[model samples]
Target: MKAELRGLPKDLAEVVAGHLVTAGMLIDDDPELAYRHAEAARRRAARLPVVREAAAETAYAAGHWDIALSEFRALRRMTGTDDFLPVMADCERALGRPQAAIKIAKEARHKQLEPALAIEMLIVEAGARADLGQQPEARRLLHQAILDLDDRRAAQLGLPAARLYYAYADVLEQTDRPADARQWFDRAARLDAEGDTDADERRDLLDGMSITFDDSDEDGSDEDGSDGSDSVEGESGEDESDEGESDEADEDEADEGESDESGSGQTRG
Candidate 1:
């Protein structure tokens, strides 16, 4: 990003860079403010692809779908790259243009994108299909993407794999396959080490009830409302200990009786 801004006057570049930095920092929590910062940067340096890209992403984060789409389109034209295709398609989806999103996805299929970008395209296309009530088509698309995943990549359990698993799991749940959905959600939760998706919470809700995933330290006890088998075993073990103590007490009493008889006989002697 600094390299991209180097073409501008130093003072103007500094200002624009500051806005971009603020935009990025707030994009996840205060997206409206982030969008404002991005827009300010774009107003100062609209010609820069990096500025436009920041504006496009912040607009998307702020739910300014039309602005996001326009900026992404401009970025694509300026850079002659299809790297932003997934986000542009998602903007179309946000604008209630599922057909346009699908079109963008189809066009993207012909381009050579990074693996993560390709997976994102599949996710957006599947979402568009679902928006059109083509649940089966959505499931097919996501399932195919899952199947096409690079084995090494999938094994890495990176964000891309987690996202793909999450999308597939969501489609399965929507299609009324709770068991299958739960399994995939479990996979997603495991892969999403960063908690980017709510896969853990989603799996716990497969039974139409929320089940909080236990993050407590393990004491061989179930805190997730499971059948309490461990608790029962603990109780049984306590019972056995009590019975053993009772038997020991009886033996001690008999030993005392034997001692008393022996002592009485010695006294008699």
Candidate 2:
């Protein structure tokens, strides 16, 4: 936090650092609280791009779509870059504004984006298409996006290719193409060792390892317990939980020796 805040004055840097510490600590376990801390940092250091980015990411994690979109817009204006367009567009989609999301995606400024960020925008745009009942278009866009990826670059970008496949598979299933869905889901699972998305669970459901059953069975429902064949929904609750990957494209970009650049007494990107 201190390194990222070095662009600010020393006094305000400490303040932002303290709030960022709180935000980072809570971001995974309690994202709402994390977002509060991030907003505090944003209030104190709204001029700094990193602070605004922190607030934007945490707000997105907490499902505060309106606030996230606002903060990302602020970040874009401050940085004069579209590095965050994918997340920003996704926030629009989350707010029940798919057309707005699509419009953001179609803007020409994003042509300058690095490959990973561009791929992320593709995923977000495909998701918006799905929201608008354009599954076929969504699947076609994602197919082109995957084909545009380089294998080595995909490996360096920390599993975006896997996520693209997952997004395509999800749209395929939604459009009632189960066999093709399974194929894409298989590709996603093979690439995603970290389980950053729910590809594994989706594959399992398609393969019928996951089952749904009535809970009111008198013969097997002993004291609300169950036999091995049919258990309650949460007995293995992985299906109910979201993977919360949100976006990872920036992580690939952020890994480019940021601390080393900050050590030279300036921020890069």
TM-score for each predicted model, relative to the true structure: 0.76, 0.74
Task: State model 1's lDDT.
Answer: 0.82
lDDT of 1 by residue, 1-269 (tens): 99999999999999999999999999999999999999999999999999999999999989999999999999999999999999999999999999999999999989999888999999999999999999999999999888887667797748889899999999987887777888898888888888989999787555333213344545555566443332211111221122334545644744443221122211110
Among the numbered candidates, top TM-score falls to: 1
Estimate, for each residue in 1-269, the C-alpha lDDT of model 2 and write its tens digit: 55668888899888889998889899999999999999999888887787898898899999999999999999889888878888888999999999989998998344688766787888889999988888889989998877777777667675778888898898888887766787788888888889888887787556434456655555665553424335313224333222452224324433552221122211222
| Runs in model 2 lying further than 4 Å from the true structure | 1-11, 108-110, 150-158, 211-269
Determine which window of 10 residues in candidate 2 has minimal summed lDDT.
259-268
Give lDDT for model 2.
0.76
Window of ten residues with lowest summed lDDT in model 1: 260-269
